[model samples]
Target: MMPSPGAAQPPSRGKARRGRPPAPISPGTGPSHRAWLEPVRSELFTSGLTLDDLVDRSGYSKTRISELLRGNGYYPAWELTFSVTRALGLPTPPLRRLWTAAAREAHKGPDWIRHCIEQVAHETEGPPLAYRAFCETLHQPYLQYARAFLLTDPRARGVVAETFDILWLSWNEAAASPDIRRYAWRLLRSRVMLRAARHQDGSPDLRAAVFSTDEAHAVQDPGHFMALTELIDLFEAITRLPDDQMDVAVLHYLCGFPDHQISHVLGLTPALTRAVDHHARATVETLLNAPNTQE
Candidate 1:
């Protein structure tokens, strides 16, 4: 039999939920993806940078950059992500984080995505499908935060419950919120942070957020919509990563999680988390770019 995750520790509150069935996502659709483009769009207007300007600077074809901007097919690889960030002279960290965040959500299996889409499709006036996709993608950001910072599954589960409670009570505010995704993210993080402060057990408290509530947008910009028809070597190679590295890389590149948060879930130092992410990317890039692997 496979080893039990709970073999060493006592029953965590998370256990009850874990044993329980997952919340049913709507049954018809898959995780929908779309690219984020506002920063580049805004910059194009303000800085007078045209498509031609980005092409010469970043060396990507106009079609490629246009695809990236228009939320069209193909996930923005790191090269494209960096190219556009530099082309716009925007700080890469936030955009990269949000970009990764969107990717992680997209990488979630087809079932979850389908459910999210179907559920929203049924709503007469819900946020756009893109935004609902964001909400579905972040379904576990709190649990992730709790695991590392809360340091125990039960407490982590408790935090997740409480955070959701806050959400339930604030439905009016949420309904009125212009950016529901970001609004929910901040609420979750704030509650997590407050709990982290109260639960300090005299150990040095480590924080794992990539973008703080103030720095990151409440709802992520719609980005990372990779069309599966375009899945290639790097995509396949990503699946080969060790679980830890894959999670870190996913959150870092796909989910936009910073090292601190990734480390918390993996129980590693921030520096080590960054290293693993680098290693994973290096490995995937190598595998992705390798030729003649047709054995």
Candidate 2:
């Protein structure tokens, strides 16, 4: 019979867990590994599920799960892996591929990648779908926003594919829960902001380039084209306003998210969202009427 979920397994007293010790990566490893693993680990740790929960649902032995995480054991045969994955409510194929890649790479050079794989393998002891889906849902809408953001700043293109990979993995893994999935969208937005801030000083021209008339016409509807132009102009004007006002304007006008959703996304009370919107509208009006500002 399987152990009950949440039951703690007694640790083998004074014995080192079997399997090879985790390999240490060299000092010169690139940023890619750290960048990749950090997000993955963050998602798992924040997922709210535990290792025993996964074992209960997946029917895999705790020892096997431990070995997989340690990077000391081969991936379970396909059927078993699939069953556990489904039980955890994760998207299957991408995770299987992730597991395969991690297992294969664990034995190769570049200790960073190996270490990351081992860490992910270990840390991701919970059921895959629940946490992964949670992370994916948090990021998908922002994926759409990222695509649009890229239209203005092509430099963002490099990270786009990697971002999608993370989203995909999260989606497949966490899709079973609505709350977790929705939170994924919020996380995606946060990531975009981080990326923008990182590149902000380096690319002043990006804003002007993205908002240009030629770029506006690419939307293909004469009405939309005109609206986009106006919107872009308004957004530029918004930048001159105080930061809080600018944030409110962007959330309401640019993203079109409902006031309540925006409130939740920004961690503000609904009353604050309304107040911010009102202040932003007043600020925009003041800016629009000021002499020498274009309509």
Candidate 3:
């Protein structure tokens, strides 16, 4: 039987083998890999399993296990990740989706991904038609928002795809919520922010430098030049705003959502939505006036 997250967990114990620690995950590793790594690391810490213990439990060599934990070398197949998660007493479904997304980020081909997935036992018959429809409806806007934030199409698509898979796993709770859209929106936001680049102060770093590229061409059209300049500054300011205000601004300005739609999407009252938008613009304007605030 597959281990459930709620299942009785193994007792924590200290490492059974000691030596120089595993190599750190390369700084250039993709966000998808980094995202999947968090829970694996947490489970390892919580279970207090050592490298030797994992090798014994997972039936993989010590070096392979170490490489998997550190996210070094090639992307892991679903079979290998599943074995490690099972050994650590972690749930498989969510991790499987995460691993799938990470595999795509690692540039593994579709044939390889399908092969990896086929190695695992089925979790459910399949997601319901309603769930599939909902996913399709949100896919474009979600991709657009993710792309704008991450500044890369591939990373955005991976994050959106992973978000949908995660939502499928909890569709019942989401459907029962007062506002399904709001619940799913929060879920997507959390996933995106988890993988987003951050400022030294820990706010999101939107990496607005892309706006400044092709300056010569942009300057040839004075109107376009001015707009791009303001846009870069505005987005930089938006990143530093408090979370609520930032979300409001992104949905309002970037996604082109009206106040009422933003209200529905975020489960906020119309009055509150307008108020948040007002505050967001006011703050952005203030930040724009402040020197050295824009990156």
Q: Candidate 2: what lDDT?
A: 0.48
Clashes of each: 24, 20, 0
Clashing pairs in 3: none
In order of lDDT, best first, we have 3, 1, 2
| CA lDDT, every model vs. true structure | 0.49, 0.48, 0.73
lDDT (10s digit) by residue, model 1, range 12-129: 2222222222122223212222223443454444455566656666777878777766656655564565565465555443344445445555575545434433331121223345
Rank candidates by TM-score, best first. Answer: 3, 2, 1
lDDT preference between candidates 2 and 3, better one: 3
Candidate 2 per-residue C-alpha lDDT over 135-157 given as tens digits, one digit per residue, 9 for 90 to 100? 34434334335544444435344
When summed lDDT is taken over every stretch of 10 residues in candidate 1, the lowest stretch is 1-10
What TM-score does candidate 3 get on C-alpha atoms?
Answer: 0.61
Q: What CA RMSD would candidate 3 show?
A: 7.6
Candidate 2 or 1, higher TM-score: 2
What TM-score, computed on C-alpha atoms, does each candidate reach?
Answer: 0.28, 0.41, 0.61
Candidate 2 residue 249 Cα shift, in angstroms, is: 3.0
